[model samples]
Target: MIPPAVLRRLNSLTGRSAPITLHGTVTPRMTVLASVSLATFLVAGMAATQFRSQPLPPSNRLARDEALRKSVNQLEDQNRALKTRVQTLQADVKAGEDESARRSGAAQEVKAQLDEQKTFAGLTALHGPGLTVLLHDGTDPNSSVDKSLGWTIHYQDLQDIVNVLWASGAEAIAVNGQRIVPSTAFHYAGVNILVNNASRLSGPYTVIALGDPPALAGGVGNPDQLAELKSRNRIYGLGFSWLRSTRLSVPVYDATFLVKYAQPLG
Candidate 1:
């Protein structure tokens, strides 16, 4: 044990402001216990800090996953709607194309019909293999074959021949370069033979036909069909001749038709 005087002297030598006072005598066992308590305090502080910085709980994570799933569903629904819109647009486009094609086809059909009507009306010139008939006054004009001028070619004879040609499938006919149509007339104006109302025809008349060669020739030369003409041709030598041709053309009907008493049927 140090004396009071010695303690004061030690404190003065160590540069202490006050003298050290030992409340109780310190032992090695007590020093060791103080150090272990300080270590335990430091470890508990570090564990609390780590817990504060941990990940979110399971409930919070589940809510976030559900929000993401809803977003995906909305996007899928929008995708389906967009696909349907695209299909609708495509169908409309296809329908428009079909309608355009149908209109084009209808126009083409009408134009085809107009062209056929023009052909039938003799407004268009025709060319094909056919025959040409020639008719003139009978020979031996003073022979008095029947005294009724039966040897001469008349307007009635022309009409008969025209009818026969029509019946024989003549697609087109022209008498003296005049196209014969449905409205054509074969009659006599006084002594002169009038054709188509304005045109006059004389002896050696020419009849141009466009059709099958053998068929036209056969129909015209049929002995039973043209019996009277054949008889006149044999007896009085009336000029009745036909020639086949590989290529023949009929002129377009240039005469204007006067629709005085005619009307459309339908």
Candidate 2:
């Protein structure tokens, strides 16, 4: 029922061939849509897989918390042990110090006891009022008179003076700065008089006897006996003197004794 021209135009439009499309070819818009859809799907799948693979938050959190608690407990135990060890060390140190102090005290006490014994033995230097006696040789004016008289200080003379001093209650006695002890001995070595095992004496011999000055003087008593001894000295041209002093200072002897033949008394 349409006009011929109109119909022919409609036929032309309908008969026009669609653009020849190459296999596997796509339009720009279609390619873009497909890429977007593929990207979306891939991203969604990856998200789902990640969700399934991941550990639960609470489970991870609890594991970490437990590990931390265990570490804290271990640390606390270690700290306690260390504290105990330190305390033990401190106690040991204190004990050692106490022991050291005790030993030091004992040593001091022993030293004090030894000092006391020495004082009691009259093996000490004496000061204060005392008397000094001198002995001289009679022969050479510097030596004893008769060669047969054994021209040096004799053991017998020393014995006599020591006995007299002891009888006089002398507190201390020294000969040439040598303290006299109960063990002290006088012996003759040839012509020389050996006192305390050493024999080298020269006049004037000095005997420091500590006692009451008056008592010491009285103890020496016989001036005639001394005079006769002096006469013997005159034959040798030797001289002697007796001096009484109120403030005499005698030095203590610090001699080391070596006992070979005697045993110590307990």
- The TM-score obtained by model 2 is 0.47
Clashing residue pair totals per candidate (backbone < 3 A): 0, 13
Taking every candidate in turn, the Cα RMSD to the unseen true structure, in Å, is 10.6, 13.2
**Model 1 clashing residue pairs (backbone):** none
Off by over 4 Å in 1: 1-93, 143-147
Best by lDDT: 1
Question: How does each model score on TM-score?
Answer: 0.63, 0.47
lDDT of 1 by residue, 1-266 (tens): 33465457556655799886657776777656644654465567668778989996779789999999999999999999999999999999999999999999999999999999999999999898988999998766675455777678889888888888898999999988989999999888776688778888887789988899899999998987878888888888888999999999999998878689879999
Q: What is the C-alpha lDDT of each candidate?
A: 0.84, 0.70
lDDT per residue for candidate 2 within 1-266, as digits (tens), equals: 22344434444544755432235667787766755665576567679888999886767889999999999999999999999999999999999999999999999999999987877565555578889888766553333443455445666777777777777777788777777777678777765666666544445578888788778777776564445454555555554567889877666655546578989689
Q: Candidate 2 regions off by >4 Å? A: 1-116, 140-147, 150-152, 223-238, 258-266
Candidate 2 residue-wise lDDT at 6 = 40
Angstrom error at residue 16, model 1:
30
RMSD of 2: 13.2
